[model samples]
Target chain A: MASIEITNARKSYGAVDVLHGIDLDIQDGEFIVLVGPSGCGKSTLLRMIAGLEEITSGDIAIGGNVVNDLDPKDRDIAMVFQSYALYPHMTVAQNMGYALTLRKTAREKVSAAIDNVAGILGLNALLQRRPKALSGGQRQRVAMGRAIVRQPQAFLFDEPLSNLDARLREQMRTEIRKLHRRLGATSVYVTHDQIEAMTMADRIVAMYDGIVQQVGTPLEIYDRPANIFVASFIGSPAMNFLSGTCQITAQGCALILDDGTSIPFLAPPNVSNGQKLTLGARPEHIDIVGNGSAPSVPATVDLIEPMGLSTLVHVTLAGKPVKIFTLARPDLAIDSTIEIAFNMDKTHIFDSETELRLPRANEPFAAETA
Target chain B: MSTPGKSRLRKTAYWGTHYLMIAAFVAFALFPLYWLLKVSVTPNDILYTEGVRMWPSRTTWDNYTFVLTQSHFPHYFMNSVIVSGFTALFTCIIAAVTGYAFSRFRFNGKIVIVALMLITQMFPLVMLIAPIFRILAPLGLTDSLTGLIIVYTAFNVPFATFLMQSFFDGIPKDLEEAAMIDGNTRFEAFRRIILPLTLPGIAATLGFVFTAAWSELLFALMLVSSESASTFPVGLLSFVSKFGVDFGQMMAAGVLALIPACAFFLLIQRYLVQGLTAGAVKG
Candidate 1:
């Protein structure tokens, strides 16, 4: 196992820059997921760590040694590509043992290593079959098997489970995490899927536009996103934002909306009165209550999506779209007015000009550390 | 298909017409080759008498024997094989590397290089015949099989490289990246992973260059003046004397000339049909 250290890693193509300066330290035996949207340079960062791509202006050290000048082979890392990229001509056993075979390991030793990995991946039945003969889920397992057999310094996954179906992707997501636990190998996985990052990583590194948005535990990032981009990008049904200006009057603090509507919330000390900012609330964090004891705002319910256990209710609050996740199957008609209250404790505030999350009163250091 | 309203009889008639048209085209293309085979077995005494007939009443092996033993056809055949074989070999090696570079790398002046290669194919070989002969004459390359090999390889490479490049483009870039991470160098990845996957493309390029060099007459006739270095196509013209044309001998030689090309295709047709890179990436 190895700890990867990347300092001021920058990637550019000619005059166009792809990755701005990025600094990250992946500890030994930690699963770090670099998650972002498309064109966000997550994969480029992973590729740079694997020595598949060169760092334009930075140092990347693997296992305490700088590998910026090394070839991918010399880097002693294994990668599972999103496409699987299994050699079509080689059988499952051969594919898994390819790295060891290249190292000129003994034939019996390579076979034993492949056998060990195949057993862990439930690929014993597929040992003699070629990649073309395997189904998509099977091929995904083989790709994973290919990486684990070598027991390299670390593993690099480039959206490795994206090609599978939903059920298979979920299953493999859990399986990969279990495998990582069993192996205790340092791994850097890159994916555009927020859920994958949330479920898989020991530390989630959320990135946007080639810059690291935040690096923290999954719940830390979820509870306190560093910026508006991180807040919106890390959640499903995404966090809803309301455009408003912070208003601190005698009767507690509230936000004055663009359309003359005001929603009440306790303002942080840093957000001064009449400062233009944005309010963020997750779908599950917004609730509908009858008594209206909490800071409540009247919203027009636009759409409702029932997802078996939970319901996603889309509402328009202060003339902005907002989603509320609730267990109660509220039989509400479209365009019906409903009183929704922000959880207040889970409510997030962002400066409109900076598009950065503003810290709450309870968490004084969230603004600096998030 | 049992799709909605489509009837079985209509589908049968549609497929029947499809096969009929295909059969018609096949016959149209193969009739000359059939005639070549038929004339090779026809005796010389009855060649003119049965000129219009598809098959002669009497058949003999005299034309085949005369062309194979009495004439200089064997010597010309060997020269054609050597030239075409070497040309195909050299062209494939050069095209594979160049095509791989074109497909995988983004280098300075790549577009200019590709445009220049394309431009090389724009002009007809006939226009450059004089210049090519002049360049080869002083270099002691003319009137030799080496001259024809070089000329054929040069003419065939650009198109062949384009062919190989398309095949390389079909393979996903991840395979090589994965191979590199699998402890293989970039060149080893190309050699071990990329090259094996490109067998079908190499087979196709080989067949193209071989047939092109085998049947090429313009450069072969112009570049070589000696009988020792003459190709089969040039030797085919020897049958055309000032008197009457030797139809039986020429047809017999033509039939023999197709054997290697046919045998070559037979050896490589498996690769052309295999589609080996099917599961190299996503299904």
Candidate 2:
């Protein structure tokens, strides 16, 4: 196991930059998941760490040694590609033991290592089979086994589970986590699927447009996102945003909507009156009330998607689409009017221009750090 | 399952189109070769008398016997084989290395190099034949089998490289990257992981270059003057005298020349059919 540090890393192809000065510190044995959208440079960063890509400008240190000038073989990092690039000519056992053989390890020791990894991944029976003979899940396990057999300084995975079917992806996701826990190897995984990052990582580094948006625990990113992008990108059905002006009422602060509705917010004292802000809340935090007895906004249901455990209600609010996840089977039909109330305590306020979280009452909006 | 009449009609219609198309193509391609054998077996005395006839009234192996024993057909056949064999071997080696480099690396001026190779293919071979002959004369390469091999390899390398490049391109880069991570260097990865998977491609390239070199006429005729160094295509023309053409013996030699090419393909047809990388990656 080894600690990795990426300092002010920058990647560029000619004049166009893909990664713009990224700085991250990964502790030994910590599972760090880099999550972002497509073309967000998460994979590029991981490849740079693995010595597959040259750094435009920056330093990457593995086990306290700088690896900027080192080749992939010298970097001592094993990567599981998205394509599961198994040697088509070699059987599963040969694929897994290839790295050790390159290192000129003894033949007996190489076989022993392959046996150990195969046992861990439950691939002993399929060791004699080629990559094409195995199912997708089995191939994925072989990819992982190939990486673990080397016992490299760090393991890098580049969307390795994206190719599998949904059910198999979930199963392999759990298997990867279990394998990580059992081996306690330092690892970096990149995926666009936020759910995978949330479920698998000890720490999640959210990225957008080649920049690190925020880094925190799963609950921290969910409970307190640093910006509108992280808030929307890290959740199912995403978060709802309402644009308005901060109004200081006599009792507490409130936001004055465009339609002249005042929704009170438990805001910090430093927030000046009449400041423009965007209020953010997750779908699950908002409750749909039946009648006018509670404070609510009138919305017509656009569509309802029943997910067995919960129903996703798509409704229009302030002339914009908003999705709310409700556990109750609301007797609301299509095009029917309903009242929705925000849990003010869970509401997030962002400065509209900067997209940074605004201070709410005595609650420091600084994101949770591990 | 009970509708036997409809099923039989459908089966017959499907097979009718399939077999009709196949039979038409087979007859179109094989008719000339069959005629070659027929004319080769016909005696020279009855050749004019049996003019334009599909089959001769009588057949004899006199043309074959005279060409094999009396003419320089065997020496020319040996020279053609040596030149074509060497050209195919050298061209495939150069192409594999250059093709793999083009497929895998991102070195400086890679696109320019590839563009230059493509440009080499655009020029007509006829225009360069005189210049090649002139260049080879001063070097004492003219009238030599080595000169023909060199010319054939130069003419065929660009196309063979592109052919090998496509095969190399079909292989995923991840496989080699995996090999590297497993402990082999890039070259070792190419040899162990990628080369085995590319047998079908290699066989195809060899067959293509071999046939191309075997039938090449322009360079062979221009470069070699000796009867011994002339290829079979050039040798096929020798039966033509000032008075009339020896169609019977020429066709006989032509029929004999195809035996080696056909046998070569038969030997490599297995490797050509087997997808060596079938179980290597996802479909």
TM-score of 1: 0.97
User: On residues A162-239, what C-alpha lDDT tens digit does candidate 2 reach at each position?
Assistant: 988999999999989998999899999999999999999999999998999999989889888888899989998799
- The runs of at least 3 residues in candidate 1 whose Cα sits more than 4 Å from the true structure, single-residue gaps closed, are A291-294, A364-370, B1-6
A77-111: candidate 1 lDDT, tens digit per residue: 98989999999999999899888988999999999
Candidate 1 — which pairs collide?
none
Task: Report the CA-based lDDT of candidate 2 relative to the real structure.
Answer: 0.89
Q: Each prediction's Cα RMSD? A: 1.8, 2.3
Q: Clashes in candidate 1: how many?
A: 0
TM-scores of all predicted structures: 0.97, 0.95
Q: For each candidate in the order shown, give its overall lDDT on alpha carbons.
A: 0.91, 0.89
- Each model's DockQ score: 0.88, 0.68
User: What's the residue-level lDDT of B157 in candidate 2?
Assistant: 97
Model 2 root mean square deviation, Cα atoms: 2.3
